[model samples]
Target: MLLAHPALLADRVREYETLSALDADEGGAAARRRMDDIAYSLCVATGTADVDAAVVAARHRLPGARVHDDSLITAMHRLRR
Candidate 1:
């Protein structure tokens, strides 16, 4: 959705990351996952071709992501001013 229509969800990923970072690990496996998410978001924000690579990196980090599916879904619907 982000890469396909970045305008629709500009900075949303950053919002998600910021909120997630409040409790996200500093430098653990989970942190790496969040970093992947950050990278992905940044790519989306910049309309960069690197979004694909970011997704792949995020996928590789999924096992250690430790993020619950419900949380992700909730994040998708959430928006910060």
Candidate 2:
């Protein structure tokens, strides 16, 4: 969804990635807080919600992002389950 809407997501991705990098350096309490704020704002603007309370509520039920994706080698394997 984000890549599909670069005009709306580019800044967001950049912001999040920057925050993540900062956090990785061992001290980013404030930056991490700001990242959460930025994320909430971006999510709201994307027609998902426009209120902090709403954003928090929505995020509470949100699923975890996939850290990695696996490629399937065969349709048969995919449907084996």
Candidate 3:
């Protein structure tokens, strides 16, 4: 599995969060389309099936992720092993 570059992942995560915070009417169709694109990219980058999960995974993969921060996915993955 190819990992996405940390910088690219960070950018996508920021873009997704920013778009998500907008009011539906404020963002409109263009923002919706862009959000969808960013969500897809994030899912692909993090190898996750859901946008929420993808976002969490992307954050954990970011450069400054705290070593002590054990997210759900990380915990689940650990249990699987």
Return the top candidate by TM-score.
Answer: 3
Worst 10 residues of 2 by lDDT: 60-69
- What is candidate 2's local distance difference test score? 0.53
| Residue range 11-72, candidate 2, lDDT tens digits | 56566667766773356677657877776766665555543443343333334433342435
lDDT of 1 by residue, 2-80 (tens): 3334332334444545645575545678766866676667566545667545444344343344444576667777854
The candidate that achieves the highest lDDT relative to the unseen native structure = 3
For model 3, residues 1-81, the per-residue Cα lDDT tens digits are: 999999999999998888888743266788778889999999999999999999999998998797577688898999999
Candidate 3: worst-modelled 10 consecutive residues by lDDT: 19-28
- What local lDDT does model 1 show for residue 47? 53
Local distance difference test, candidate 3: 0.90
Q: After superposition, how far is residue 68 of candidate 2 from its true place, in Å?
A: 17
RMSD of each: 13.7, 8.4, 7.9
Off by over 4 Å in 3: 24-26, 70-81
Error in Å for residue 20 of model 2: 1.8
TM-score, candidate 3, is 0.76
> Which window of ten consecutive residues has the lowest lDDT sum in model 1?
1-10
